[model samples]
Each structure stands twice: as C-alpha cells, then as structure tokens.
Target chain A: MLASSSTRPRRVAGFLAKSAPAVISVGLLLVTWELYANHSGIKPTILPAPSRVLEQAILNRGALIDNAIPTIRATLLGFACSLSAAFVFSVLVDFFQPLRRALFPVFIVSQTLPLVAIAPLVVLWFGFGLAPKILLVALVTFFPMLVALVQGYEATEAEIGQMLRAMGAGRWRVFVLARLPSALPYFFAGLRISITYAVVGAIFAEYAGAAKGLGIYMLNAKNNFRPDLVLAAVAVSAVLTLVLFGLTVLLQRIAMPWERVGREPSGKGRRG
Target chain B: MSRLELRHVRKAFGGLDVLADISLSVGAGEFVSILGPSGAGKSTLFQLLTGAEHGAGEMFFDGAPLDDHGRHFAFMPQRDALMPWRRIIDNTTLGLEVQGVGRKAARARVAPLFAEFGLVGFERHFPAQLSGGMRQRAALLRTVVQERDMLLLDEPFGALDALTRAALQRWLEQMWRHHRWTALLITHDVREALYLSDRIYVLSARPARIVREIKVPLPRPRDPTAAAAPLASALEAEILDILLNPQPFKGHDDD
Candidate 1:
C-alpha cells in the first residue's frame, strides 16, 4: 500500500515535469494573444481570438469532420506509397552500384524542385482529384525515408557482415540478416521526420487544387472574411500532424521492441 | 594430412606488410590458437581466411584447395554483434536462416542449444538486455549452430571483464571437450593461449610471421588456476618472452 501510494505521486510528477515546458509556453502564448486581440480592438475578421476560433471549430464540427476524413485518407495513402517506394528504391540502390551512382544525384535534384510549385502542374496533368494530392505528398516525403534507409544500410558493422559472409551467406542473406536490422532505427527516425511533412504536403497539394480539404476550407473561409474558420482549420492541421507523428513513434516502439532494453555498460579490459 | 593448412600466406597493405610468409596447419577436431601482440596481423589472417580481403596465399581445406574461403568455417568475432532488433533465439539462428532454412526451422534448431550456452529463459531477450558474458555466449551459440567444418574465433572473450572472461574461458573448455569442433582462436593473452589450445603459434609484431610453434600438452578441462603450475608457468613465460622481445629475423626456419 505504501509503495503504490508513493509511486502514483512520483509518476504524476514525472509526467508533469516532462510536459511542463510545452504546457507553460503554449498557455502563455494563447493568453497573450487573447489579451492583445481584446485590448487592441483588432477586427475579428483580421485576428480572431483563440476563443472565437475554438467556438467556430465547434460550430462547424460537421463540415470540419467531413473535410478532415478526406485529408486523413489522402495523407495515409500517400505516406504508404512513399514508404514502399522508398524501401524498394533503397534496396535497389544498395544492391546495384550502377543505379545508385546514376540516380543518387537525380534524387537529390528532385528534392531541390519546390514541391509546392510542381503540385499545380501535377494537378494540371492528373486533374484536381485525389491523384495529384497523393502524388505530391508521396513525392515530397520520399527523400528523407530513402536517405535514412540507405544510411542505415551503410551503418551496418563491417565485422558482422564479414561474419555472415563467412557462414556461407550470400549477398542477399547478408543484407536481410545484418544490414536490414541495423537500418531500423534510422528508418524510424526518417519516418518521424517524414510523417510531419506528410500532413503539410497533403495540405499544400490541396491548396494547389482539390475538391475538398482543410486547404480548400481555409481558402473559402478567407474569401468569406471568416478568419476564425481559417484559424480553426489551421489548428486542426497542427493536431493532425501531431497525431501522425505520435503514431510513427508508436509504430517504432512496436517494430523494434529490443530497443526498449537499455544497453548495459560494456565491461572494459585488455583484449585477450 | 592436416584438415586445413596454409602455406606462405602473405598480405601487404600499400607500404606496410601485415603478414609475411606465415604458414600453419590444424588437424581435424584440434583446438589451435594464434597468439600475438595487438595489431600483429592476427585478425588480418582471419580476415583473409574469411575472404573479406584478398592476399597472396595458398589455403587447403581437407587436402583440397580452399577456393571458397568462407564456406567451410563459422566465424565469431570479438564483439557479440548480435542484431539489436532480433530476439536471442532469432539472433542465434541467423546463420541457418541465411542458408535458406525457414525461420521456424532455424529457431527450432538453435532452441536446444540456448540452455547449453547458459541462455535459458533468455530466448526472448535482446542482446542489450543480457550481460556482457551472456551476449558473448549467445555469439558463440550463433557460431556453433551453423555446424560448419571449422570455427574461427577472434579473441572471443577479449571484450569482457576479468571475472566474466575467466568464467567464459572455463565454460568454453567444457563445451569444446564435449563437441570437439575444429577451431582456431586468435588472442594476445598468454594465459588464455596456454589454457585453451592444443597448440599455440606465436606471431611477431607487424609484418607478422610465425615466430614459434609451441605445443600445449596440458590435459583437457584445464583449470584457470593451473597458470600457477610449473609446466603452464614455464610455457607462459616462454610465450611472453617471445611476444615482448623482438628478435632480428634470421630466416633460420623459412618453411
């Protein structure tokens, strides 16, 4: 009874300590914004208070939900395509030297092209359905995961690879057994980075051209002089990005359960 | 005839010669060790044997030319090198899975050896979860599970603490006594060499060559305390002398 009682307070303290910075900063910022909007006599059309935004979001709950579904679907589908393609391309580049040499520079160059600039052209070609948005999201998010996987493959320990080869394991076996597992941490790191971009990419693609999405809703709200609705939609997108980021972390935890075991301090001495 | 033999195996990296005319042989089921100082090219020779590097050498396995340098040996390096993402059982079965065995079949094959390796109840544990000695044992289990014709161990206990290293050395002896696997070990420790090998080859510092071949006629399952015994002490002193004192190469026994 004593242990349980003491542990509950300790756990709560730990949680509070971890989240204190985010909570304090965000709360302060929102309070300052509320005070400025009220005292400065700013027009609500130009600067809606956080309260007005929250109220508008609640009032338009049905429209918000309808739009959020399509955005979520497009983001997930596009992210999936990006993930599989990155994996396949990474493996091919790892296995084939010529392809890596020929295409690596091109891949980097592809990243340099402002992805948003191309979104409209993609929409022009594919039409303003889900295709262009999915394409844009996949295209924009592919590079980080690909880079992570390739680096991860390279990060494989040379001795481990040699050990595997000495066991009569061929190239594929060495890759599957050693290189692949070594890359998982890097892959997850890449996933975390890409998942955030995935939502932003989806939103940007919608901004270019889309039948319905937060990007379109914000645009419509802006034209109607309803800044509150636009701010509400922006809040929703931020929440969406955060949720996807958390899911990526959860996936990593599940995929690499061994990583939960903290590494023991290696004992050191003269090598025999 | 020896089960494996190397004749005039030579390797040089640019201006530095790592191995110069080193030749050795090991009979079937014999435990042989190569002893040398750090950076004496002991590991280089193993790398060459593993086909990770190419060198001018002739290696024979079972009296046939060893064209396929790696197919006959299971190698265990200094570090455990366990995959951090895999469970202990899966890590141990890596070799079998590489050889095209189904994952389930490979797991079943190595599951019985976990207990023998002192890894009972750790079949589901990760390498990070195990102590240093346990990880090393798991590495050894990974090596032996292959059932290759020979085992190449590069300072298998080199990374552990003194107590853990001693415990593992004793455990290895007991395991080897029962299995009688043909093995070659590379190490720098004089006592470790004296305790484990049927024969020990002393190699010279860089541009390493076999300086002397000493036979260890000590009985099986030798005690770690036996280093204090006269015969073992004398052998240890002699090996240490050879390692510490550098003699000018006279080419007295080239072959």
Candidate 2:
C-alpha cells in the first residue's frame, strides 16, 4: 500500500512530463486560430474561430455522434479483419517458400497504388456502403502488419531455434514457441502504425462515397458552408485515432507483461 | 558399461576435414572434458554427436547402437540461449515441453530443482531480469530437466567473468555429484577441465584428432585452489605442452 501510494504521484508527474509539450503546442495553435479569425475579421466560413467550432460541435453533438457510430464500427471491423488476414498470410508465407516468393512482390505492388486513386474505385466496385469503407481500411492497414510479422518470424534467434530443434521439437512447434513469441514486439509496432491509418482510411472511404459516417457529415457541412461543423468532425476523427492508438498500447502491455517485468529494477546485478 | 561411446568419428565440411577419426567414451556416471584450441572443431564434434551434422561415426549408448541422438542427450551451447520472452520456469521446462509433456507437469517437475540450482525466486522472472550467473543456471536447469542419459556441454562457462565462472564451476561439480548424469564438456580452459573431469581428452588444432587422454587421479571433492596438487599440475602442464608444441605431438597419435 505504501509503495502504491508513493507511485501515484510519480505516475502523475510522468504523465505530465510526457504530455506537457503536446498540450502546450495544441493550446497555442487554438489560441492563434481564435485570435486570427476573431480579431482579423476573417469570415467564419473561411476560418472558424476556436469558440465557434466548439459551439457548433456542442449544437451538433447528436448528429456528430450518430455519424461517428458508423465510422468507428467500420474502422474497428476493418482493423480486426486486416489483423487476422495479415497474421494468416504472414504465417503461410513464412511456412512455404514458394508462396512467399509469389505473394511478397504482389503485396508490394498493391501498396504503390495511391489510396486517393483507389478509394473511388473501391466505392464504385463495392457500392457506397460499409463494405467499401472496411475494405479501404483493410487495404491501407494490411501491408505494414504483414511486413512486420514476416520480419519478426524471420528474426527468430538462430541459436534458440537450433537449441529447440536439438531437443526434438518439430518445425511447427519451433515456430509456435520461439518464432511467434519473438515476433510480438514487431507486431505491436506495426499495429501502432496501422491503427492510425485504419481510422483515416475509413474517413477517406466515406468521403469518396458513403450513406452515413463522419466523412459524409463533414462533406455535407462543407457543401453547406459550415466550416465550424467540418472542424468539429475533424476533431472527432483525431479523437478516434488517439483512442485507437492508446488501446493498442494498452493491449500490448497486457499481452506481454514479461517484457515490462524484465525492464524493471529488480535490485539484482547487471543482466549481462 | 559406458553410457556413450564414439568410435572413429569423421566429419568434413565441404572438402575441409573438421574431425578426423576421433574416438572417445564416457563411462556411466562419469564427467569427462575435451580440451582443445580455439579452432580445433570442439563444437563440430558436439554437432556431430547431437545429429546436427551427419558424420562417419559409430555412436553407442549402453552397449546399443544409438539411432536417434536427440532422445539420449541434452545439449547446452556456449551461450545461455535462454528465450528472453519466456519466464524462468517456462524456459527451464522447454525441453520437457518439446517432448510432449504438458506445461504444468513440466513446471512441477522442475520446481523443486530451482532452489538447488540457485534460482529459487526467479521462476517467474524473464531471462533479462536475471544476472548472467542466474541465466546460466536457468539454462543448465533446462538441460537437466530433460532427463536424458547424457549431457553435451560446450563451453558453458566460457562467457562468464572469472569470479562467476569459478563459482559456477564449483556449483556444477556439486550438481554433478548429486545428479550423476554422464557429462561430456568441451572447453579450452585447462584448469576447468582438470578441476571437473575424471578424464580429459586433449585435441589437436584444425582437423581435430585426440592427441592425448589423461586420467585425473585426484579424489572426489577435489580442491581447485590446490595449485600444488602434483597430479593436477602434471596433467595441466602436459596438456599445455601438447597444445603449445603440435609438431612433436603427432608421434603420440594412435591413428
């Protein structure tokens, strides 16, 4: 209890230390925008003041939330599907040499097609429904995860693999016990990058064509000359990205507690 | 009967000979050391014995020709090679787990030995959490938990500092006394070989062949600090002489 109590203040201090710069910068950005629009007499349609954006967000809370539900759902479903498919593809490629040779180049080529160019095509092919949005998110997020996982699998410590093989472990058993666990850090790294892309991808897909989503809401606001509402939708998308990134970090911590334990001061001698 | 016997083992990598007509045997419950120079293929010999490399050899265990080398010997390479992600208990039981034993049963089997191996409270700790000595002990525990008939240890303490190495050498002697698993250690430290083994084989440089075999006549619980022990000094000097002067030593070759 004493240790826990003592650590609480330290935890707060650590959080402040990490977040202070970002908070200050964002605060400065808002203050500058508010002064420029309010004092300089810029029309709200061209540059909405911070207060105007906040007020408009408050007024449109119900619509914003209603649009957010579909966007969040699409992002999550796309991310989940991408993760599973990437894992299966990576494992298959790792297992079979011919498949890796055949599929790796294709994966690289697929990533080169600009998302802006493909978003419209995906909407046209899948229709302006949830399918296009989810597919767009999956396409944008899949490559990073696949590349990270394959690298992780290939990076299994040679000596450890040899040791397991000498112990009569089969190939699959070696992959499961040694390679899979070794790949986790890389996997999480990929997840952090791809998770941010997931939300943005869904928004882009919605912008191309969608029945309901934050992207559609923002598009309507823009057409109606409501800059404050568009800015409010942007804020929602930023919040969603932050939430997803934070969730990935939390999941990583929970999944690999041993990694954290090893780094703590256990009051022992130097590890090496 | 000897627990393991290697008769005229010959291994070649490409066109280069690594081990040529090497032969040795370890009696049941005996500890033997193979001492050689850095490039003398000591590790290659182990690779051959463990079936990581195919070589022309006749390997026998308990008077029977050994078919599956992996089933009969537990091996520890020079590095600790502990999986960083696995906790100590899981790493210790890795061999048993690979052999199809359930994780819980494997953990139970190794739990009692943790204290004896100086890893009592570190069962749940990861490899990076422990000190170098602790990691090595955990690795040795991993090997011992396999319950194999013999152990092939290649320079297990070579990477440790002088103090830690000496301490672990003593601990290893104690563990060997208690467990009595036939062990074959490959090392370049003459003192380590003399201090631990009942018999020592001195190998030549490249294309390693046994140059000499000396018996350690010292009694059990031998004192490593007994620099004056006549037999230990004599064996050490003889091995050093053979290592330093390789040309004349070929006269002693039985092959």
True contacts kept of each: 0.54, 0.65
Please provide, for model 2 over B190-224, each residue's C-alpha lDDT reduced to its tens digit, 9 standing for 90 to 100. Answer: 99998889999999998888888999888878776
Q: What TM-score does chain B get in every candidate?
A: 0.98, 0.96
Model 1: residues >4 Å from true position, as ranges? A1-17, A263-272, B14-16, B102-105, B252-255
- Please report the candidate that would top DockQ against the real structure: 2
The DockQ values of the predictions, listed in order, are: 0.43, 0.65
lDDT of 1 by residue, A139-197 (tens): 88898989999999999998888888887778988898789989999999999999988
lDDT of 2: 0.90
- In terms of docking quality, model 1 is acceptable
Looking at model 2, residue B122 earns an lDDT score of 82
Residue B96 in candidate 2, Cα distance off native in Å: 1.9
- Judging by lDDT against the true structure, name the best candidate: 2
- lDDT per residue (tens digit) for residues B89-202 in model 1: 988998888777899899889988878898999898777777888889999999999888999999999989999999999999999999999999999988998899999999
Best by TM-score: 2
